[model samples]
Target: MAKLIFVNLPVADIAASTAFYEQIGATKNAMFSDATTSCMVFSDTIHFMLLSHERFRTFTSKAIVDARGMTEVLTCLSEDSRDEIDARIATAIAAGGREDTDAAQDYGFMYGRRLEDLDGHSIDLMWMDVEAAAKAMQPPAN
Candidate 1:
């Protein structure tokens, strides 16, 4: 089987968190889901495992950080285009997530935006056009 990535997150509300993810383009993978956990599939190889706080404790002894107060990680996903990234940000906000206060990043060849989910998990969305990036590196006419 191909290598797969499962991003595990501690969530206060499984239902709400699952809904939030679905709103932003994910499907529930029932094979790995239960009352206290949800396996949200972003694509063939990318998945998110949202576990209730109590359930998440089983995996670690360390206290779970309150994401709202601290940022332990910044999870990013690539989009096909800038428009797709923007649409997802809008969808996320409408579903109760908030946009990060950081200013938008535009490197001419790449663009990105960030947001915080209901559980305060930082999610960064970005798009990069490889051809454009290569072209941009060439010296301009003198």
Candidate 2:
């Protein structure tokens, strides 16, 4: 069996978070979803476990960092094109998510935009030029 990856996030409201994820094209896994956690499937291998803050806290004794005004982590997904990136960002905004930054970055070959989820988790929608990235990784020309 293929290994599965699950990214868990703490949300204040499970229902609202589940709805927001659904709006962005993630499907819920009823088999693992309930009042505390909603298993949102992003792909065959990737899933997001949206857990209520209280439930999430039970996993660790450390305090949960408030993402609203701070950078906890930035989750980036690569897209095939800039248009696809834009559409994802648009859908996120339409679903009550906010833009994390106004700047659109264009690194000659790649372009990206960032948005914040309803819970203020940073997400980046990006289009990377594979060839360009490979070239950039090469040692600089002397």
CA displacement after TM-score superposition, residue 23 of candidate 1 (Å): 0.4
Q: Write the per-residue lDDT of candidate 1 for residues 1-142, one digit (tens) a residue.
A: 9999999999999999999999999999999999999999999999999999999999999999999999989899999999999999999999999999998899979999998999999999999999998899899989
lDDT of each: 0.95, 0.88
Roughly what TM-score does model 2 have, to 2 decimal places? Answer: 0.90
Candidate 2, residue 80: the lDDT equals 83
Best by TM-score: 1
Local error of candidate 2 at residue 125 (angstroms): 1.6
Quote each prediction's TM-score: 0.93, 0.90
